[model samples]
Target: MDCTNSKSVLKKLSVALIMFMFLTLTQGYQISFADSVALTNSNTVTVEAHFTTEKIRDGFYTSLVVNYNILDRSNIKPGDKIIIKLPDVCRDIKPIYKTEHFSNCTVNGDTVTLTFGPNINEGVQGYFTLYMYGNSNIKNNQNYEATVTIGNKVVKANIEGVAVDGGDSYPDMYKVFGTNFPVNNLGEGIIVDRNKPVPYTIVVNRGRKNLGTMNLKDTIPNGMALDTSSLKIYEVSPNNNYTDVTNLYLNSGRVNMNYKHLQIYFDPGNMYMVDYNTFVTSTESKYNNTATMTDYYGNVQGQAVAILGSGAGAINVYKTVDKKNIGNFGNQNIIYHIKFDSFGTFLKGTMHIQDKINPKLTDIKVTGTNQFTVKYDSATKTLDAVNDKSTIEPGDNAEITINASMKNVKPGETITNTAQVNGGDTNTVHTTKNPLIQLSKVGIDNPNHLLSGAEFEVINADNNERVSNIVTEKGNTNILITSDKPIKFELPYGNYKLVEIKAPNGYALNTKPIDFSVNANSTIINLTAKDNPTGNIKIIKTNDLKEPLQGAKFNLVKDGKVIKTGETDKEGILEFNNIEVGDYKIVEVSAPKGYEISKDTSVKVNKDQTSLVNIVDKNILGNLNITKIGNDGAKLSGAEFTVEGPNGYKQVVTTDKAGVATLNNIPWGTYTVRETKAPIGYE
Candidate 1:
């Protein structure tokens, strides 16, 4: 509000004074803002410039008196100068600059929009441009919201600033407008509106006598309380109106200027009030994607029962649609309506009707890339390009791919993918399980690139084991699996045991076991031989000392022929089955008694290993003796007796006789007692 001494000699300034003041204050001293950016959307991206910076000049929409900073380090302009540049984008359509923003960084225009790019390959990216002087100067180092040309639309960002604040030395906060008021008068620093309302965030010291303010009025009358929490100033001013103010509470004990501290105008009819009206008419709003906008204002700031007004002075509060998926709750909205018909008259103040119809935070996009974190330049408003690096083991190739899992994914829908590796890779994987790859209008419909698929594979490794059966599924992007022949696998090459699928194209598939092995403990396996033999065949488990196998089977064969089949019982004895009594070979067809694994490679019907073929399995108890003498018989336990058996068999056993003795299975021989122990009964 350049309400300075321009009125110092108000009623009595010489005609010369008026002329000099007008020349110094409103001449061709233009404010130009540019956003110079070097970007690559592969090369560049489009841009859109919205108006929210230190408001542009006073009257002519473009000739803005920017006080707040928009393109610097802190977002608050501390100086009165700025530089902006936009990306050099190419468009199929022409008529480069919008109505006001021509290639020539025009002086005082309301809006400016230019084009940047849609890279030769895809889209675009770039910068903004700004220029200003006076209270609206682009301060030294402050970041401001800016816009650029993108394909057919405008892209925007908080373009960083180049260090241009206090010329020679770099200071944390630069100063351009009001003089720095002393501690005692901290609050006395005149708040001005340089066409562009300067965004001021004061951090006041505690326990200090805070400063006070008096605007467009003469005397500080009695009982006019100046409570930092609430003020009685509205009563003093003629029109009594304030745009904004911070609340009464302290921020971490410090008095923060959170918009709650704004005071109503002392006199709405003041020329500064004229400036305020202009700010209202040219207001540029940012609807936070909701359907309505909310702006809170208070008069009688210190009073409990003050009626609040909206940005355009109308008194209705608007809410957003509660259809939740669209973030209806935390929506920011605004609508501005204005009528300057009676703007300067005290009596017509009531006739200067105004109202706003703006979008709420719910109406604009709050999705897509939500929050951005990056290194940026203070003066240039350019995002610092970051360099990244990585490495992999020998004999490996690294690939990074992006993908879109579905063809036409709905906005906000979750997505998934499937991937694999041909040449083995050892690189650690970054993946998503049923990763909620949410979809947005910009990125949906992209092909599932290799990288995304690989990541999906990494995440689904544990869950995909059970997916089964794809019935006649086919597509370049669709997963598929089929076997020309049964796939076979085994531990030892030919032992074909199992088969499986590593990755599916589109449809999900399950794993299959192709081949398996078993421990065949089969005994008496069939080994048939055709009969061309001339004689019977016999097989044995042991030499002459033992008979045939206790539980063995055999087949007489002549050239692998089975002449006859026979088995041995628990007793080591077997017959010659049925065969010609001639030269013939005996083959063990079944497992033998008490034998783990043994083979009779080839056995002829010849004499056994020890001949005789007499070994039997019957238990034959050794020699026993019977002795008798007269009437008395003796039963001896420890004496040996010799028995004479037919066939010249001789044997011995301890005598045990009571006129009768027993012997077990004495091999069909007749025996007589040749010797007796102790001359039994005194024989």
Candidate 2:
């Protein structure tokens, strides 16, 4: 057995001896024990008193040794008082009493009060010695308890030691033990040894002279169940130990559940033994089992108590997201927790736990206790936590945390992941779908017209802030739109504007920002912009008769420059198309075959507006020559002619020597010629 187990055994023996002696003597006596039994005396000191009698000539030298042990030396000061009220047995026997390490001690009735001085260590000890009458007829197998008072603390003195009384020392008692529940009951609480098998055993002393059938009854502790098939019996031969007699028991199947207890019957002459394994099923830390033994006729033999350690050696995991259920379109943080608990046992072995990280998570970072080493593998997407010295004591837990990020999740898609611990349990979490926005570029004039090479930017019109990198949004990567293709964005719920940043060549830039919302799933928006107008101008060239004239050239001028040059067609129309809205001047560069050049005409062109200007040209003049002869027509000299206009205005012309006269300027109209004077007229 280990040192801890040895201490536990010694403590049990001491308690049994003291209790048996006290109870055996006071069984028929009318004695008043202490009314109340408190667990602790004071925060600074714990007092224990033990009584032992030495054989003397006329009486027994009963010594009541009160050991004052300081639990916290720093908390005690001088002048502290300790009062110990002895059992009724010391009432008439306290003849001579003395103490050590006490400033003063006084006896009053059955109580002794001692005042403390300075110089007290945590391991300090003090004793009180006294004498008792030999004829008192003290009984064996009895325990005498006292009441101890320290400062303002009051408690019962539970100090117990093995008391022989006189005889009755039997060395053939059976022992029951929990192999896995190793503890030093004398020092403090239960101390568990996790490396041992989880089993309970009953062992009988070897070389027994004569033994009868032994009956044992044990109740299973909470959170533990006995494995019926694991029950095994053994018979020791004094020479060869651990001989298996498990098959000899015809009633091995009788170890079934009997109100959460186990009972066994065995003949004790051959040093019989029985053991079974217990399975732990709960998280409770401590387990206690009490076993009682009896002879065939039901005569009480001995009782043994077993307090086992259970509950530890477990791992648990939990996962949480920063965005809760909604998984944003982009990168989001996911947090995980890993916990290891030793339960009611001490874990001192190499422990390793691995978690398969979901492929959707990346950039994993683990932070926790320095005792564990954590590593992540990208190929397998797993995180392994291992340690060589995982010293986790009972009732304590070690936890580690991991933080990771998940990226590029789409809208209406959930990102779910599961985290598991090795030889333990698993937990899962997922995200919900968020809203999305779809934007398309369009022409205002034609809804079906796909406008290419138009770039747009989406911004929060409320604050004029550009939205990007939203955690749950479908990643805010580059949003450069092109080629009339519709652009989709998973954005946070808000009001936004789509502004045209750049437009195609020969197209007007839409300076207006289109406002929309992304409050619901699949929110659709289309931005419309109109192209600048390409207007036209028409010029008609005609004579005074207001008819169409051909072969007329005209220059269309805008802003003092010739924008286009065109001649009138067969219909006498000079037309200019696909021109911007502005003031223009149309000048006739050349006239038709029989018309003069028309003057410049000013006109203003607007969007989808047609302007028409009419230019009238007058006909040119002609010269005529005539000769007056006697009987034949000859070249005339000094001939005069009159040209009449349509408005009744006349012009006179005279023919010169060569019988030629020219009319320099004349209007195109109906005219009549009259010979006013003829030199040598022949007609």
Candidate 2 to truth, TM: 0.39
Model 2's alpha-carbon lDDT is: 0.53
Model 2 lDDT tens row, 1-683 = 00111122222211111111122123321122212343344455555443332221123223343434343445666677777776654433342211123445566767766665543321122233333333343344345566667877666542222222457344344444555343222211122222223466766545454657766677777756677777787877777687776665645643434536777676767776677766544323245655666664444433333323221111113445555545444446667666543321222223455777767667878765654777778789777776534444333446567787755445555666554433333445665556555555555445676667777766787898776553313345534454665555565677877777876543456677778776645323344545444467888778777878889888888788998999888888878876666788988888765567777889987757678788888776554333444345566777677767644658777777777666655654456778787766444
- The parts of candidate 2 lying over 4 Å away from their true place are 1-181, 186-196, 204-211, 238-240, 250-261, 297-538, 550-557, 560-570, 574-581, 587-600, 606-610, 617-683
Q: lDDT tens digits, residues 402-479, model 1?
A: 211222232233222211111111112221111111111110112222211111111112333422321121212222
Name the best candidate (by lDDT): 2
Structural similarity to truth (TM-score) of each candidate? 0.22, 0.39
Q: Rate the local accuracy (lDDT) of all candidates.
A: 0.24, 0.53
